[model samples]
Target: MSAPGAGPALVLASSSPRRRELLARIDVAPARVASPDIDETPLPGELPRDYALRLAEQKARAIVRGEGELVLAGDTCVAPGRRILQQASDADMNRRFLELLSGRRHRVYSAVSLIDADGVQRSKCSENIVKFKPLHADEIAAYVASGEGLGKAGGYAIQGRAEALILWMSGSHSAIMGLPLYETRLLLKQAGYPIG
Candidate 1:
């Protein structure tokens, strides 16, 4: 199926609502949303930035051959120093992550990869710093109970109910949500997609 705007069919190799929403912000909706099933385990001694880029590229390449369509994939990671934080799957994990991030600065890395119709691949990375306010146990418990951190890297969503926990943030707000709009638009343009 073709996207609302006419062009070569574009495929988003991801299932992230945040990524889809960011794409909508640029008016470059995907013709298909295909979640590339790839193992996201970090490589031995792999830095967070490299890990994100590698995963993004792997995701795009996993779905792109002979499809005759452009494929876009992205990966986001949150790191506190050299430690990469995994997506919280339960309230206990979320609470622990929040505690770790309290009154501290962490980095969010978002990597995007685009494989054009010609099979030429291009990629970019976005990094943002976020500072969390000191949180009381009750506050953390409430946020965890809200269930907004599940499936989210860093145990928080800058665009969701966890917004109140942020003391300050420096970088692309969209990147924090999982996609960097500026870089995504550039990749779309390079893939010959029309963007307004």
Candidate 2:
């Protein structure tokens, strides 16, 4: 069936502006953007990759849509070792997270899920390694004070002031910012979302 009503032609089950911007890069505009309400907390002992994929798929299926409509969702996670660093909610947590990541490489996993009209689901995950320069106490303090990392995973926003601290990286930049464009575009196109 054709896109339902006058929506963009797809449904984006996320509220992240970054995800929306990433989608625009591939020319896939959602017919309706519904921020899926779901528990984002990781299950006990869940690995970062598993958590990210579960969240992405859960978000996609959580959104209410017609049988003929399609929904897309995504999740990004920062993991140092097997530990998943959650979104920093305060300056203290930001400081602690940054200190842990001061001069080490961490994994950033981004997972995308697509649910088609017939309820078929497809997903892909992109993993990247990001290394940050050893940060001085003052530097971490200042970054925390800036508050850019407060709402970000692993207590940092790679797209903001935190970029200056990145020493090297290998992986999708878009994935670190919360969405993996290459994987996302491929998924959307394969699902017939009219994306480039």
Quick one: best TM-score, which candidate?
Answer: 1
Please give the CA lDDT of all the candidate structures: 0.88, 0.89
For candidate 2, give the lDDT.
Answer: 0.89
Q: Write the per-residue lDDT of candidate 1 for residues 1-196, one digit (tens) a residue.
A: 2256477678899988788888877777788888898998888899999998999999998885555688999989999998888789888889999999999999999999999988999999999999999999999999998899999998889998888889899999998898888998898887888776
Worst 10 residues of 2 by lDDT: 1-10
Per-residue lDDT of model 2, residues 111-176, tens digit only: 999998778899999999999999999999999999899878899988999999999999999999
TM-score, structure 1 vs. true: 0.95
Candidate 2's displacement at residue 26, Å, is 1.2
Task: Tell me the spans in candidate 2 whose CA falls farther than 4 Å from its real position.
Answer: 1-8
lDDT of 1 at 51: 90
Clashes of 2: 2
Residue 154, candidate 2: Cα error in Å is 0.8
Q: What is the lDDT of residue 30 in candidate 1?
A: 82
TM-score of each: 0.95, 0.93
Clash statistics: count for each candidate: 0, 2
